[model samples]
Target: MAHHRVADGKNSLRRRGVSRGLVFMLLAVLLVASGVVVWFQVGDHVGREGDAAAATCVEGPATVAIIADPDIAEGLSAIAKSYAETRPVIRDHCITIAVRPGDAKITLDGLTGNWDPQANGQYPAAWIPQSSVWAADLVTAKPSVVDGTPESLVTSPVVLATSPELGAQLTGKLDWAQLPTLARRDDSLTEFGLRGWGSLRMAMPTGAQSDASALAAQAVAMRITRTTGVLTAADASSKGVAAGIGALTEAAPRSPDGTPVGAATAIADAADAADAKAAPIHAVPITEQRLFQLTKADTTAKLAEVLPSGPTPLADYPFLKLTGDQVPEYAATAVADFFRFAEEPDHLAVLTALGFRGAAPMPPKTATVTFPVTPNPMASPETAAVVDINRLVFGPTS
Candidate 1:
C-alpha cells in the first residue's frame, strides 16, 4: 500500500510542475504582445509628431483668401500683390493675400452653401461682392454667420453705356420711362433723322442672377411702378411691370447661338466691333466705373454714361469677413489689414485710377458724378429672389 501511495504522489508532483510551466509561458506571451503593441504605438506617435512639426515649418506666417467680383479682379489682384509686398507684420504674422475673382452671384451662392472646392478654390476669408445688396441678402438669410458690419469699400452707380456717336445723337432729355420706347425694335427714331437704329440692342450684366442686372431690372420696375423705395414681390409680378421687364430682357444682346452673352464679354465685343464702324450693342446697362474701365482699355469704344431720373442702384462694394471656424483669427486680422490698406489715401488713388469712386472727396481728374442722397439698399434677399423668379418667368421669348 505504501509503494502505491508514493507513485501517486510522484505523478501529482509532475502534474504541478507542468501547470507552473504553462502559466509562465502564457505570461511570457502576453508580456511580449504588450511590448510589441507599446512599441508600435510609440513609433506611430513619433511619426505623427514629426508630421505636425513639418507642417508647422512649411505653413506661412499668415494667409488670407479674398474673393472679389470678376470685373474688379485685376485691380484687386494688383492691389493685393502690392499690399503683400509692402505690408508690415500684423499680430506677429507676415500676411499673404490670395485674391480670386469670381462671378458675384455665384460666389455669393457658394458662401450661402457648401463651398465647392473645385469651382471656388479654397474657402475665402473675405468677400468683396459687387454690391452691398449681396451682403444684405446674405445677412438676411444667415445673420448669425455674418461677422461684422459690411463696410462699403467704394461706390459705383449703374449707368447706361452708349457708343460715342449714339450718345451724341441722343443728347436730348430722356428718362427711365423712354427706355422701352428707345429699346423697341420699331423705327421710333425716324423723326430724329436717325431713321432706324436697328432696334436698340442692349446688354446687361446677368438677368436677376447678378446685382447689376437686378438693379437695372429694379430701375425698370421703378419706371413701371413709379415708386422707388423697394419693389416688393407684388410690384415685380405686376402685369405691366412684368411685361416691361420682358421687353427689356428681349432687347438684351444674344450670341449667334442665341444665348445671352455676359456683360464683360458684351462690352468687349462692342469695343472690338466699334473699330469696324459697327457697334454690336447700341446701349448696355453697366456701372459707371465699368464704363471708365472700358474706355481706358479700348479707345475705340469710349462709352458715355446716361443717368436716369429715378434713384439708380449703386454698386456699394462691401468688404466683409466670413464667420465661423473656417476663417481663423489670423485670417480675419489679415483681411482687416487689407481693407485698411485699400482705404488708405494712396490705395484710394489706385482705386480711382481703376474707375472706383472712394467715399472721400473725388480726386483731381476723376469724373464728377452725383448719387442720390438716399439710395435704396441693393434689393433685399427676399426682393432679389422675387426679382429673379419674375425674370425667369417673364423673360422675353423673342
Candidate 2:
C-alpha cells in the first residue's frame, strides 16, 4: 500500500512540471510576435535615422543643397551657415549648403519633369521658392512633395517703391486712391509727364514693369469700377503706364547728374534741396526688410519705405522638402532638420538681417494657408502657361 501511494505522488509531480513548461513556451512565442509588429510599425522612424547617418557620415562635410530664387540668395546663404554651426555637432553629421537661384516656375519645371512627379522623379533635398503662388503649383502637382503639406517661412510685399516726394504729391498719404490722381495729373506731358512722376531727375521707367506702375493701373481700375486690363507685359510697357510714373517723378528732386535720388536719400537730399521744412523727394521704395537694411547702410539716407494701408498683396516665401522614391530616407531627414533650424529665433534673425521678414507677429499656426481643393497640374491647362509680366502683375488666371 505504501509503495503504490509513493508512485502516485511521483506521477502527479511529473504532470505539474509538464504544464508549467508548456506555459513558458507559449509566453516566449507571444513575446517574439509582439517584437515583430513593433519592428514594422517603427521601421520608418529607424530607417530615417539610418539613412541620415549613412548620407552625412563621411569623413568630409555633408552637403545640403538649396535651390532658391536669386533675389534672396545672399540672405538665405547666411542663414544656412548659421544653421550649420550647431546642427552638425549635435547630430554627429557635417553639413554643407549649396544654393542655386532662378525663377520659381523654372525651378519646379525642372523638378517634376513636365509637372508629373511620378514620371520626373525626385531631385533636391529642399527647394525655397520665391512665391507662395508658385509653391501652390507644386502642392497641386504633387500633394506629397513637401512632407505631404505646404510650408512658408517668410512674407514680403510687392510694392511700388517711390521717392518721398512722389509719395507726398499723390495723397499726403500713400494709399491706393493716390495712384489715379498721380496718373491723371501727369497725363500727356512727356517732359516729367504725369506718367513719369515729373521727370524728378531719376529715370526709373514708369511703365507696367515698375511695381508702382502696376499698382497705379490696378488702383485706377479698381477706383473707376472697371476690371483693369490684366497687367500684361504689353500694358506695362505701354506709354500710358510709363507717362504716369514719369509725371510723378518730375515733381521728385534729382541729383546734379540728373539721376533720381532714392527715397531714403531723397529725404536727406530734400533737407539740402530746399528749405528744411519741405518734404524730401521720396521713391515708393517697396517696403521690404531688405529695403530697411539698404536705408540703414546708405550714408545719404536717400531711400524711404511707404508702408501699405490695408490688405496689400505680400510675397510669400516657401521652404519645401522634396520626397519620392529617388530621394533616400536619410536625405529627407537631414532636410527636415535643416528646416527646423531655419525656424529658430537666432536663425530667423539672420534672415531678418538679410532683408527677409521673419514669420512672427502672425500666429504660428498661420504659417501656411491651405486650399480646399488640391490643384491638379496634369488636369489644369494653366499649369503649362509661361510666366509673363501680365500674369505676374495681375493674377495667374487674369
Candidate 3:
C-alpha cells in the first residue's frame, strides 16, 4: 500500500510542474507582445513630432479678417474660400479668411475718425473700400492713416443707369460735362423728347451712399472746371464746380421720410415695378457690377446703362491695410500673401465670372449692349479732389 501511494505522489508532482511551465510560457508571450506594441506607438509619435519641428509649424492657425465692399463682397467671399482650400501657409501656420461685407461710407468714416461703435464697428485689419476716393478722403483728413500706397484690386467704370424709357432716349446723346447745364433745367428731359419726364433728374450717390456716386460727382466737377488729370481740391471748392454739384443734387428725388436716399433704392424699385409715367428718380450713376446685379437679380426688369461720353471716372477698388507701429510681422506677411493670392490670374477668374474687370482687365461681361470702354487709370479723378467735392454735393450726413 505504501509503494502504491509513493507512485501516485510522484505522478501528482510531475503534473504540477507541467502546469507551472505552461503558465510561465503564456506570461512571457504576453510581455513580448505588449513590448512590441509599445515600441511602434512611441516611434510613430516621435516621427510626427520630428516632422512638425522640421515644417516650422510652430503656432496655432491664423484667422485673417477682411472687410470688403458689399458690392464686391460675394465675389470676394468665393475667392476667400478657394484660398483656404488651397491651404496657404503664412508664417508657418495654416490660414483661414473671414470676409465681412461693409458699407463704403461707414468704412471710410471709420478710418477718417468720428467713429462711433453704433455707427462704425471696430476697424478691420484690412479694408477693400469701393474706390480710392475714400482713401483720398483719409489722406485729405490725415495722410498717415494708410501704411503704404493703396493697391487697386480691379476697375469698375461708373455708368448712368435709368429705366428703359429714359435710357433709350439718352444713350450716347450727352456727356459728363453736359450734366450740370441740363440736370436742373425743367425742360432737360423734354428736350430729349421726354416731355412728361420733367428734367434730366439724376441721383448721385455720395458719402455714405456709394463710391460710384461720389465718383460721378467728381466727374461733374472735373468737367465744370475744365480740368484734366485729377480734379483738385481747389476745383471742388470753385464756384462753378459747387454750382454744378448743387444743380446735380437738386435733380435728385426728394425723400418721402426726409431721410437720406441713394440711387440703389430707386433703381431696385424701378426694376421691381412696371414702367410708369411718373418714375421716382430719373437716372443715377452706377458701377458696371451694380448694373449687372440689378439686371441679373430680376431678368424681367432691365436697366439701360450708358457710358456717358468724354472722360468718365472709374471705380478703383483699392486694397488698404491698417498700418501702425504695432502691426506684427505675421499680420503684414498675411496681408501680403492674401494680396498676391487675390491678384493671381487663376483667382481673378472668380471676379471676372461675377461681371467684373479682372486685374488683367477683361471686357465687362456685364455689358448687355456693347459700348467701347477703354479703362485708363488716368480716367480716375484725384481722390482728394473727389473727397472735397463730395462735401459740396452731398453735404454732411450728421
Candidate 4:
C-alpha cells in the first residue's frame, strides 16, 4: 500500500510539469506575434517620413512669366528681377522667378496644350499682364485654369506725353479739359510728323515717333475730335481746328511723321536741353500718382501730372494663371505668396515709384464712366465694337 501511494504522487508531479511547459510555449508564441506587429507599424511610420522629406527636397525653382506692354515691361521686369534676387517663399519652399516680355494677348494664348511634367515648356508658375481686363477674359475662358481670382499689383493712367515746349503752350500746366481745344486744327501741329513734335521748334529737335507712342497720341486726338464737331482728320484741319492746333504747336513741336515725339529718349533729351533754351520746354508727362522714384525729381523741378477734369479711365494690371490638366503644386504656392506680398505697404510703395497707383481695396464698377473701355483682343468683333463705342467718348485719353 505504501509503494502504490508514492507512485501515484510521482505521476501527479509529472502532469503538473507538462501543463507548465505548454503554458510557457503559448506565451512565447504570443510575444513573437506582438513583436512582428510592432515592427510593421514602425516601418510604415519611417517610410512615410522619408516620402515627405523627398517631396519637400525635390521641388525645382519657381518661375513667373510676365506679358506686358514695353512701357510697363521695363518697370515690371526691374521689380521682378529685384524680387528674385531675394529668393522669396512659396509653400515653405524657396522660389526662383523669371520674367519674359511679349504682347499680353499673345502670351496668354500660348498657354494651351500638353505640358511636360519636367523640363522645357512644362508650364509657367504665374503670369502678370499689363491690364486687369485681360486677366478677366482669361478667367472667363477657363475658370479652372487659375487657382483663384486674378489680383492687381499696380495701376497706371494713360497720359499724353509731349515735348516740353509744346506741352507748355497747350495748357501752361497740363489739363485734360483743354485737350479738345488742341485737336481742332489742320496745322503742322495736328499733322503726323516723322521726326515727332519736336521739329516745330528747331531749337530742341528729337527723332521719330514710336509706334506705341503714336497709337496713344492718336487715341487722345480721336477722343478730342469726337468731343468737338470734328469727324475726319480733314475736318480737324479746318479753321475751327486752327485754335486747337495753335495751342498744341505752342506747347509741342510737330515731327515729319505727323505725330509728337514722346518717346523716352526724346523726352529725356528735351528735358536735358530745357535749361539752356529761351523758352524752357517742359515734357508734358502725365501719370496718376503724384510721386514716383524716377519722376519725383522731375516733378519737383520740370514735370507735372495733369489730373483729368472729369472722371478719367483708370488702368488696371492683372496677374493670371493658365488652365492645365494638372495644376502645378509650386505654381499655386508662388501665386498665393506673390498676391499676399504685393498687397503689403512696402511693395505698394515700389509700385508707386514705378508710376503706378497701389491697387485699391475697392475696385470701381464697370458702369462708372463711359470712356476708355478695356479692350479684349480675344472678344468677337461684335462685342469689341460695342465696347469701343462705349469707350470712345469719355476718358481723359482714350
In candidate 1, residue 243 scores what lDDT? 70
| Candidate 3, number of clashes | 0
How displaced is residue 207 in candidate 1, in Å? 8.4
TM, every model: 0.67, 0.51, 0.76, 0.47
Q: What lDDT would each prediction earn against the true structure?
A: 0.64, 0.48, 0.69, 0.44
Global lDDT for candidate 4? 0.44
1-398, model 4: which lDDT tens digit per residue?
Answer: 45644556655665435577899999999999999999999999999987676556445555644345444556556666667766665554566555555554444455543334343344565666554434544554455666665666775554444343444444334334354343333343433332233223321122221222222332344344453322344433434444443344354543333322332224445534433243233333233332133244453223333333322434456666544544466656665665565576765665655556664332221211111332311111122222232222111111
Q: Clashes in candidate 2: how many?
A: 62
Instruction: Assess the local accuracy of residue 386 in candidate 2 as a C-alpha lDDT between 0 and 100.
Output: 16
**Ordered list by TM-score, greatest first:** 3, 1, 2, 4
Give the winner by lDDT: 1 or 4: 1
Candidate 2 Cα errors over 4 Å, as ranges: 1-62, 87-95, 112-122, 140-146, 177-287, 359-398
Q: What is the Cα-based TM-score of model 4?
A: 0.47
Where does candidate 1 stray beyond 4 Å? 1-60, 81-92, 136-144, 191-193, 205-211, 228-234, 255-280, 297-302, 360-398
When summed lDDT is taken over every stretch of 10 residues in candidate 1, the lowest stretch is 363-372
Question: Who wins the TM-score comparison?
Answer: 3
| Worst-scoring 10-residue span by lDDT in model 4 | 362-371
- Alpha-carbon deviation at 376 in model 4, angstroms: 24
Q: Count the backbone clashes (under 3 Å) in each candidate.
A: 0, 62, 0, 29
Model 4 lDDT, residue 151, Cα? 60
